[model samples]
Target chain A: MWRRRQDPDRAAPEAALGAILAAVLAILALIGPAPAWAAETAAAKEPAGAAPAEPMHVIVGYLGQEEVPRQPLSFLEPELQDEGVQGARLGIADTNTTGRFLNQRFDLVEAVIPRNTDPAVAIAAQMQALADKGVRLLVADLPAERLVQALDQPAAGGMLVLNARAPDDNLRNEACRPNLLHTIPSRRMLADALAQYLVWKRWTRWMLVAGRYPEDLAYAEALRRAARKFGAKIVEQKSWTFEEGNRRADSGHTTVQSLVPTMTQGADHDVLVVADERDIFGEYLPFRTAEPRLVAGTQGLVPTNWSRVHEQWGATQLHSRFEKLAGRWMTPRDHAAWVAVRAVGEAATRTRSADPEQLSRFITGPDFTLAAFKGQALSFRPWDGQLRQPVLLAGPRMLVSVSPQDGFLHRVTTLDTLGDDQSDSRCTRQ
Target chain B: MGRMRAGLAVALGVLTILPGGGAAAYSVYVSNERSNTVAVVDPETLTVSKTIPVGRRPRGITFSHDYKHLYVCVGDDDRVDVIDTASGTVVDSLPSGPDPELFVLHPQKPVLYIANEDDNMVTVVDTQTRRVLGEIQVGVEPEGMGISPDGTVLVNTSETTNMAHFIDTTSLQITDNVLVDSRPRVAQFTPDGRHVWVSSEIGGTVSVIDMQTRQVVHKIGFEVRGVPKEAIQAVGIELTADGSTAFVALGPSNRVAEVDQKTYAVRRYHLVGQRVWNLALSPDGKRLYTTNGVSNDVSVIDVAAGKVIKSLPVGDSPWGVAVKP
Candidate 1:
């Protein structure tokens, strides 16, 4: 019954320490004292048939979401796979209960399309087969385009798709579709979150370092939009090219310091930002630079989906519980996956049925609110159908700051204001 | 200002430490798994009095016989922090075996037995001098350990071993080992000493051990995915003084179950919060509190009503719940 209030007034602490403490207390309050209103609502609404059976039935279908791993020479590292299918499996246990409430039973059965498979055709076949088997909710971790294609098919049937990936801003804007509830926050929102923190720290002037990779450049473009949208100024812009395994003196480090001369030349400005999504040179810019700069993005002050070590705000407990259940630390996308299932649970609690129309209505209703494990209340944008959330701006070891930093103070802060909120949406599906 | 902070910490220490000497009031303290502090609260007043810092990763808690000291199980630190009742400072530490969790102190004896969750053993310590008495190997993942009223018997619950280990305190040996349930934790003996109650968190069942026969005579089951249920993973366990009722905390299901001790059947299931770990009941047995680790609050359940009346907020990652002296 403990529910996150959609109150716009809730905020982070004065500084870093204060932020952690407040987040812990705020999250504790949400999980601790669930008002009778939520319990009464769940009891009054959930379909009696959702309750557990002896055998414990659950149905799970994969959206075949990964971008084909591109060159197949991807690192056999833990974090990559850690973020994908492995994280999606948690939806099984999560689909049964939302926020520790287990009114429903999950009998999980998986329908997966192998990598390199066409999600449009393959997912449609899987969705049809699953729908006939009484599975009403689909956890679609696919890209924005594949998601639309998968949803458009009459063969795909009328199942509500729980969006788990594709963090593009356009998806929740002009591309927003009905019955598609995203768990991924758009890059615009995430950048704005980072921008809010910088502005709050009075680091108004920024030096931008763009990565050579295409995706990195796109992220840099988002940062540019965010910088201009906020009051901050990007004083200088520079680009860094990566030669694999090269750590040259004139690599990213010199290029970043070279920009510092012009960006802060005889002028007072804080923060040096880097946009390196390819994971090549971003890890080297911090502390290696000449000045004592507060580096951000793929470097000193990067924003991540989630970190295993962030326990300051009761996140350790969340990590431990997830590790205890899944036998591993939680990843970034798992947050999205967990949110998807939790949204389904919330919708199920409200509508009392797994029926597609009723559940989708319950989820998309203006009054609908979901807890996204980030100590915040999460809801969908009617425009491109992206999930609106505050991104966790993190460093390698400690949290630099949370985005949507204090003092930007809109009804929902400039963080929510940046992404597609209720005011700026085009599709209006919500 | 620093002096005042220290004075307040001292006064708070005295209030929570001293037995009937401090005040005629009730408060709750919970140990967080992640944070290095204990959340203190005045339960009756419903206020968070203070969050006193402590050693690393504290989990279980128990008070001294005369309530002169409060012992906290700091699992990662590998020691039990003893808080002096008068000063409210961690005066000393007891050497508990590795990864100590969940404690049960003998009322009269100077002995404190701890279930070492990781080392798969029970650490018996002398509370008077704050020293390790000896260690006794029991089962894998020893979680909950409790001593009998007579101070002669100690029961340890093993999570993966699926057994309740009975130890002879005088001899410091595991005299009898009887199998129970999967993930057996939080073992306690009946008040009158007729039977012992063991809760299998993941097993979702409570096994009753007959004291005389030394066997699991009765098995208490839960209707809601009892131990075998994929969703409901139970952890915390406690029993009333009269031995007529018991309570079990379920983690993911976020519910507390009331079991009729006589019939070994669940009478009620009250929803609470996620990842609940430890349990504590008032000496009068009217109110029960459980530490919800994930939710970061203590579930204050009205035992008679079989409902969670309120939840008391605590520090980050609250995992162990204990009542102040």
Candidate 2:
């Protein structure tokens, strides 16, 4: 079932827009020589003067392209069926809360493409259908390549799509699209955030351990770039191969305990950075390291856009709200989707318009900022359309630190130093 | 017991005034969020006279009409602990809705309006009867309660909703809603009740709304020379009684901005301890006390000189401050 609900009782007040005095006069004139209770009931039923304003409807579509469900190594983590869409639903609810007072209502239309289908064709069809329904705002929870294909669709040309899933660097760098704005932080941004924290703590030497997956290699490359940008040195590097075994079966720790330490034995470094983006061996490398070095990068002490351990700067308020709605802790993807939908809502509220062009222009232009419990105002970067925000460095049970650390300065904002700055960006969008 | 505590406080005040010391006319109470205690400080001695333990995660604090009881919003416990001001101890608990963050007492009545952040509603309670009056549905994360000087209109700013809701006190109905910047933390009315200044923390701006029209008339922004714009978050706002000057606490910027009320210009920035959260001014309007959240201390300011005179250490993470005159 869809999460959209229409409240019939939320009619716009007749006395809105400085018409209280006129409404009072009209009420008195309508119920002349009537009993007080009758007068009160008549006034409560409907104002006697002006017709009530019709609430404006702003509809946003959510397009989720199917992918293979990821299986976690441990049983504690399960595959989430509705990660991004739940966040969009919460976003709609939050926006409707504010929209009720402004005589505006928000609705979210969700559609998911089945797995093993031609994603390009599915994306185009979804876009055409959504556009036919007058949904000019969309949240795309697709891969980097499919996202580009979706934007290239004729129907999507007139729509504004917020990228809530993919975080590939090239999508933001050389292959940027004009209609796409990213809410998820890029891999390079996460690497830079972690590197800054490690460098600030004087942990300059790192042992880079990468996985065989393409995403893992991409993340490893980002870590290398971050090390070069900051002052950290990669003392050694290793590539891990898949070992077929049930990680949660009986006596599973014995296998991982021996393999991880042997794999980490040859490095002389202050920290071990794992590039296992998939639910792989990264979670097993923390306490099983040869040296007692802290594990970071994709697991252990990791840099993330959102975490359950974060509670400062009114984060508990958002965490509780999301938990109440979704019945689970808010994930990074959920937060990404939430911010994407909220960005559209915030733009509509501030600009007081439902037109996609005007809202998109205001969002990309100067003077547009959104606050999503990050302790700072977030805005889209001019060059790449990447969001500028602080990344949380979190352990499993506690928030260790926040990046864009102290002493890291920039000409404009310290947040710009984490992601690709405009000067070094290769994006052609203006 | 009340007379005994007052006598002891007077005797200690006399002892503290032996060496060119002027006895303070008020006592300062600060809620420590991390320590779950309220630190009571003597303004004259510039030291904590006593520390009273309360419920977990004490944040918003206020006083009763007669100043006989102090109410602390124990957020984690979902209740308000009432501290007997005379004894400097918690005496009772008021049944509040879920996660009450901030609240305001009616100026001339026994009604207390509490913002239930978790429930997205405002819980109205009669302090004298200790009974629930009504619950008004509000925006998301309702915070920053402010009442007009005449006590006819109440303004509650919801942080996530990004709107300042104006409620009619008599009918308990929302009259008007004014959209503001993001994460509005505090709302303070002018002395003459002509305007309400709402501080938006993440938006880093203060919006001044005309009370009559319920529209934003002017917006005030803050900028520190070396500090980044994101760090200059506006949280607590204190306006002078004469309505000429306003002091705003800049969270994490470690500075308090002094604004010219008439022109809406930031005149100067006063550097204080780390993460200055909430502020309270003395009754005579001469001294200002700031609760530094990160530094676990309170910075005392000389309003005339516009400089920090002293910083007295307190419990961990002092959140809200109130002065009893």
Candidate 3:
């Protein structure tokens, strides 16, 4: 019913505070008795169906793989087998909570490919099978290559795929696909979120340390781009060549304590920025930096899609609900998957349709916004199909801040300042 | 000009400190979520006259029907702290369900309808007997409680469920469930009880639902220049007694929108403080008070003047506001 209007004219600036405390003594003189709670009355209860109707079933397919789990650097941070799927499950529950009133029932059909198999072949067969089940909506938790292969299937051309796992920037840029929408925050977005906060805090000099993996290098490249974009200077860059050890071993701290300071000794920088996406050495960089410099990016203070410590914007309730359902803290992948499933739910609820075409159009349309517990309404970019949302800069046990920071303004939404902007985007698809 | 403004401030300050002999004096209570305290603001002086210490994470606040006791939702403590208005201290506590967020009172009865965020149910408590009458199951994360003017129909909105549920008072049954936008924070019924305006914090729109038909008649959107649409989140809504004008708190945009009630059009925006979370109107409806979460302050707006008069610093993370005459 509401329509967008032309932007209102700007108003005058704010005025100053002039009033002072006049009478401090007059505040505490009054006293009154509390009310007596004596009267009691019984009320009868009757159960009635709020909305009684035959529910329409909407099926959503989840395509993922049972990947060989990698042990995390810390014992507290365990690699979850049901990470992405748990979130999708929670999303289905949440969707059905709203869908019940609308007479729309949502069912998630999960097909996780077995380990040590050809992912493309498995994805193709799974896509065909899901398509046969009349499941047009899909939440893909696959990696970049597998996700692309899954969507490249002939049957997937009609299916709307929500990419929930891949954080690779290429998927949101040169390799962007019209049918595939990404809910995961790209590497560039994560880097830019941290960069904005660092620049806002006036920590402009960065000591960049990266691992040898391709994902690490890609994240490091994004950090470099963010530094250039946000007016920060990368004072020095280093490659970590140390082999990982048993994370829970008692001797691990001594080695980390010695090697980290040695690797970070002589950089005249304000912060040590780590790009160890494989979780090799980033967690050890903090408190062991050469000059008491703050460590961020991938560890210490991390720019992430979601964190366990984030409780703002009514996220505490969400976090509580997820913990009750998943029995673990939600990771970034879980949050993305949840948003992906919830986006479908939101689109379905708004459009009142289960048709994949209608839901996809409504989701990518200008008016479609997902309230994903981020204090902002998140929506996908028309140019790149990337979800634009505020990235949380989180410490290990608490949320530090969220970016785009206060003054980083954008022509469109401020969330566009984090990732590939319209002008910087390489994707031509709308 | 600076000297003249100082002189006027001193004169206004002196006038407020004196006891009101004939004219009615009102006290504005602001719940500081982070501070776990309530700021007792003097409406006349536009200053925090007293600070009442309460339980942890106090959020939703309101006065009893007789305006003698103030009920503050202490979420961490899982109870409602009752503050004696005259003494400015917490004197008693009520057994509210776990993580009580927001609540409402029946117009002509000593009954409290509380939104228990953790339980996904509305806990109905008898105010006079301090006993929970019943718990009505609603959608997930139930908040935004509203009772009709005639105190017959009760409405509760669930943040995640995105539905404003209409409940029958006598039978305690859900009569109708009207789906609105995402994260509906507050449901404010028009004084005449013809419609209910529900503010969706993440949806960035206020859904105006016709009470008779239980359908959304209109959706009101707000826009302010130099501010992003995400920041212009619709949160708390305050409608005038005559229902001619409605003021909506735009969260994180630091603005309050003046809207035309009949047309469902945003008239203009008055810049307030950062993350305006909720609103309260003075008894006379001539002034509006907004609790700004991030800034830890309260912005006072002169309703008829269409401008913010002052920003008074309060405790940390001011979440809710209530006014007592």
Candidate 4:
């Protein structure tokens, strides 16, 4: 049997000693010229005083909508219940854990709009309400345009807004806001990560297939830029016009098997790269491609922020903890939201300040670094406030690789090799 | 200087008296995290002497105060496996709370402080009775454990919390918390007890905190030419007896940075195996052993030579290393 220490009285003397030392240092500072170390020691001892100060309150608003529509794919792709919110919830829990030690308190005010409602009006109203409630740190899970609208709202003025869902390149470029920090990796970054890996493997020739959606075209455009940057060749390109039918129907498999081969028939390339951000037809081309080639991009071997199969760098513990909490594997949105909130926790703990402006300054300063279970410390690019992280190349069941591959060099960091660097930045904000 | 000389003299006397102890006969015990085994390597021959099987996911290893038993944190088993050094077999086990990752023993007392990573607590156990004494609530995901030279303070670095919690030994309560860079993985007290060096694996820097003020006086970062900044992740730290030179294992970069303690400057980078996680210095302070996780090898570094002398193949994903005193 273990004897547990139940008496809190044992801590009283230590606290009392701390208080006395603080008082002595305070007196020494007031009386005569004290050494620099004395002032520093006094500041360090403030947290140990007998009477614990009131915990500094930091309220963050989770602004988003529930039940967003998904692509009509396999029945195995279940509707996500707590996609972005659960990540913020876990982030709050993580923040509270560190907050407890720092005499700080973190609270999340959720303002989720209904799926059927007008998102812009509902989001604006929620932002106003959150501002009324003194919520200054906001995690926006809205689309790129709606996120921009929310950022432009007067209620969001002076607030630090973290974009957790939007991965639009314009968010980190020409339309980037001074107060908004982007946690999601842009399409360009994802494309570059995949391109680097493919180039490293010498799979330089690509047969590009794109879905007939604006998002899909944008992703294809990014991939095209990456191919040009990394010296890869796009041997052929084609757009898919076939509408996705009921994926679970009996004839669905046969239809996909016949349609994909016809769509990929004219291409002779090393790899078949599909750009289908909506997941409409990318999964169909993997095993049914014409040339029996390796498939990559938005489906087959995809680039993502977080994967259920990633269990390296102590991510196994995080994965298991999330499973225990949410009863499911963590998604990329969850990881982004978690990173956003954890950034707040880290800044507050380091600066020992709860002021929103001070926190924002500290977060953007050179000292800010966040550990998001990615094996490396992640920091925001000062120019665009985009979190720089390694993109994971994952297959269906395993992590294929992490890119910014071995030889991809950058003056700042290898991570810069993935995203927009200082030289390429359209963001004018310092 | 006199105290250090006396300590060296005592170490020499122990080496002469102990059966397995000698200047050139020290053994290095490395825990292979993924393989669930401990590889025992002889320093003189630079070869693995024996492979001892242990529980699942064994990490963070150290020797008992009397040097009679080796304590290994079998993380998946949620207990500490005590191995008798003479037989190189498990003799007993201690209740080390849930998900024990790393631990430290009080220099003069029989108390063992174990960092329970998942439970967010440090379990203190009595080695003589194999019974837990008390549990101290700490930051989340605590991994690193370091004790002051006098055993008055115990430092535990929480991975996710990113702070080093300093616990008073007598009160068993947190006395101070120093925020380091992100994902602090290991902490070590300088031999002179003036500072505590903490390595932040994700932040890619080592924070040297002043012991008296409990403040980070210097944040030492590495810059290996041609190696990306993110790859220079400082994880394991080993300080010399004189506290003049420090060696830091840069994870994933496959290099160990030798730093000057006083100036906090990296003097040289020695190429090692992939993903070097932990390091151990010999009792005589002549050789350093590094456990490289990805390459599955132990890099033997000659301290005076400031370079890797040899790489000995070990089990898969070798993580923590402990040297026989």
Better of 3 and 4 by DockQ: 4
lDDT of each: 0.63, 0.83, 0.82, 0.82
- Estimate, for each residue in B108-127, the C-alpha lDDT of model 1 and write its tens digit: 78888888775657888887
True lDDT of residue B149, candidate 2: 83
Taking the tens digit of each residue's C-alpha lDDT, what string does model 2 give over A1-430?
1011333332222111111122212312323222232122112211112355887778899988667777777677767888888889999999998787766788998878777788777877888888888877789888777788887889876677889989899989888866677899999999999999898899999999999988999999999999988889999999989675655588888888888888898858999999998868898888899999899989889899999999988889889989999899899988999998899888777766565655666566565789988889998887788888999999989999998887676656778878788777888666
Residue-by-residue lDDT tens digits, candidate 1, A1-430: 1112244444322111111112222312323322332343323311223434443233444455444342211233343444545556555554443311223455444565556776566767776777777765677767666777777777444556777777766666677555566786666676777776787677888877777876677678888887877778987777775345534333555565564444333333477788876566555556554456778865667665577656543354446546776776676667777667656655554444444444555555444555344544456654455666667877666776665554444433233555555555665453
DockQ of 2: 0.23
Candidate 3: docking tier? incorrect
Q: B-chain TM-score, every candidate? A: 0.87, 0.93, 0.93, 0.92
Summarize candidate 3's per-residue lDDT along B1-325 as a digit string, tens digits.
0011121122212343444442336678999999999999976667788999999999999889888999999999999999999798999999999999999999999899999998889999998899999999898899999989999999999998878889888989888887787889999899889999999988888988888777777788777766766677899888877768888999988999999988988888989999998998777676789999988999988776777778999899999899886
* Predictions' DockQ, in order: 0.05, 0.23, 0.22, 0.23
- Of 1 and 3, the candidate ahead on DockQ is 3
Candidate 2 lDDT by residue in tens digits, B1-325: 0011231222211334533346556789999999999999987778998999999999999999889999999999999999999999999999889998899989899788999988889999888788989999998899999999889999999998888888989888888777788899999998889999999999888989888767788889887766777888999999888888889999998999999988999999999999999999877676779999999999988767788888999999999999888
Residues A339-404, candidate 3: write the lDDT tens digits.
999999987777666766656666766667788889888887777889989999999888999988
Of 2 and 4, the candidate ahead on TM-score is 2
State what share of the real interface contacts each candidate retains: 0.00, 0.38, 0.41, 0.40
Off by over 4 Å in 1: A1-58, A66-79, A94-103, A107-134, A155-157, A212-214, A240-269, A287-292, A321-329, A345-358, A366-372, A381-385, A412-418, B1-55, B59-69, B73-325
| lDDT score for residue B317 of model 2 | 98
Clash list (residue pairs), candidate 4? none
